[model samples]
Target: MSERPYVLLSCAASIDGYIDDNTDERLLLSNDEDFDRVDEVRASCDAIMVGANTIRRDNPRLLVRAQQRREDRVNRGLPETPIKVTFTSRGDLDPQAQFFAAGDIEKIVFCASSAVDKCRDRLSGVATVVDAGNPVDLTAVLAELAARGSDD
Candidate 1:
């Protein structure tokens, strides 16, 4: 197989090619049918990732909504929910966000070396914080995820 985990980027955009309208309220880009499709995709993956901006903006739980899907993962010897990941430069994240509080699965945070101490202090009980060099290296993050058995 490959040295790194297979990465899949999933998102929805409007017909006008806009992701959001810069509103305080969250936008609904996908309908119920498409949301079910996304749930299926989440069930198949070992992990799911978003940036700090996404967490700050959307505050998503990133959990498997279908009970059966969560059960299927447990039957397959995996966590009920996929591992959640996020990367940040300044490490400005709320400890009480849904991303940290809503799931029983592992949460990994990649941050710049300079921000490691502060990030760890803030997210100490909430996530596993890793320093990814001065600028937060994506390559290192991927390798670390692969090592943790995240094949997706």
Candidate 2:
């Protein structure tokens, strides 16, 4: 079998191990320097993934933000940003969310088998909705992503 893509899990949390607090607004867990570092990491990746809840709550653009970095990627024959990916059991994602709306690159949604049609219907123009098994098998999802050439 072909090798699966390398998975790099990146996150920021408070000293108490909380990524966020109970608030309507999203918490700022990282400073500007930290954000710049993450942007560099994102630039090096083949795809960037977030949970559906993050899309709902944080509404992040999930793009490599620096203009020069974007140009560099394009000059390398890559997209301005990497593919955007998300997984959900409920498939309750907003097509208008920045995850879907911001990038010119591909957007992929891996949903529970039961939610596939719903996600496909809801995210038709926004993302490529995939059935990642009934409970959303993460291993299979990663294999599929590797097959699609997201090796980083």
Candidate 3:
């Protein structure tokens, strides 16, 4: 069996353990320094995964903002940015979201088995949706990522 990928769980939450409130605008959880640090971390990763809700709510580009960091990644024989990954249970994702629109690298969506077809039809050219078992098996996801050489 292929080894599971080394998962790095990164998030910015409040002291109250809230990542955001019910506001339409995203909460500012990090400062310039923190963002720079996060960018460095991102540059070192082979892929970055976030929940489907984060994509819908935040609409983040998920790109390495520093040109030097992106260039460094290229110099190391990597893509300009890491592969973008997202998980979904309902497959209710917007194809036009920045997650799909911004990056030239591969985009993967792990969906509940029940929603795989819907997600595939909806995402089509934008992303490759995999059936992540009924409850969406994270271990399997990591294994698949590892098999794809995204274990870092």
Candidate 4:
């Protein structure tokens, strides 16, 4: 088995290589068929992660949407929803966002070392804040997640 969680970065981009059309309204980049596929993937993973910008922009719940999928996870001794993770440089995440408020699963925030204290203070009741070095170390973040038993 691998020491770190298997990471999959999924996204939809426009033909022009942009994720959005630069509008205030959220764009629908993926179709319903793709959404179902994404739900399946979410159900299979031990945790789901996004950046701070994604949390602020999309405000996703990141939960397993299908009841059967959630049940399967529970039957397999996993939470109904996977753990949620986010990385930030400024720790400017909103505690009221669905990323924090929508699920009973664990929420982890990897922030820059300089912002750790501030993030912990602000997100005390919402998420567990971890320092990710001066600029938010991706390696350390993955290692920590591995330590927490997130294998995928």
Query: Model 2: runs farther than 4 Å from truth?
Result: none
Q: Please name the candidate that would achieve the greatest TM-score relative to the true structure.
A: 1
Clashes of each: 0, 0, 0, 0
Which wins on lDDT, candidate 3 or candidate 4?
A: 3
Which 10-residue span in candidate 3 carries the lowest summed lDDT?
1-10
Report the CA-based lDDT of candidate 3 relative to the real structure. 0.93
lDDT of each: 0.93, 0.93, 0.93, 0.92
In the order shown, what is each candidate's alpha-carbon RMSD?
A: 1.1, 1.3, 1.5, 1.2
lDDT of 4 by residue, 1-152 (tens): 56788999888887789888868788998889999999999999998999899899989999999999999999999999899999999998889999999989999999999988989988999999998999887988998999999998
- Candidate 2 pairs with clashing backbones: none
Model 1, stretches more than 4 Å misplaced? Answer: none
Name the lDDT of candidate 1: 0.93
lDDT per residue (tens digit) for residues 61-151 in model 2: 9999999999999999999899999999999999999999998989999999998998899999889999999899999999999999998
lDDT of 1 by residue, 1-152 (tens): 45789998898999999988878989999999999999999999999999999899889999999999999999999999899999999999999999999988899999999999999999989999999888888998999899888899
Preferred candidate (TM-score higher): 1 or 4 = 1
Kindly provide the TM-score of model 2 when superposed on the true structure, using C-alpha atoms.
0.95
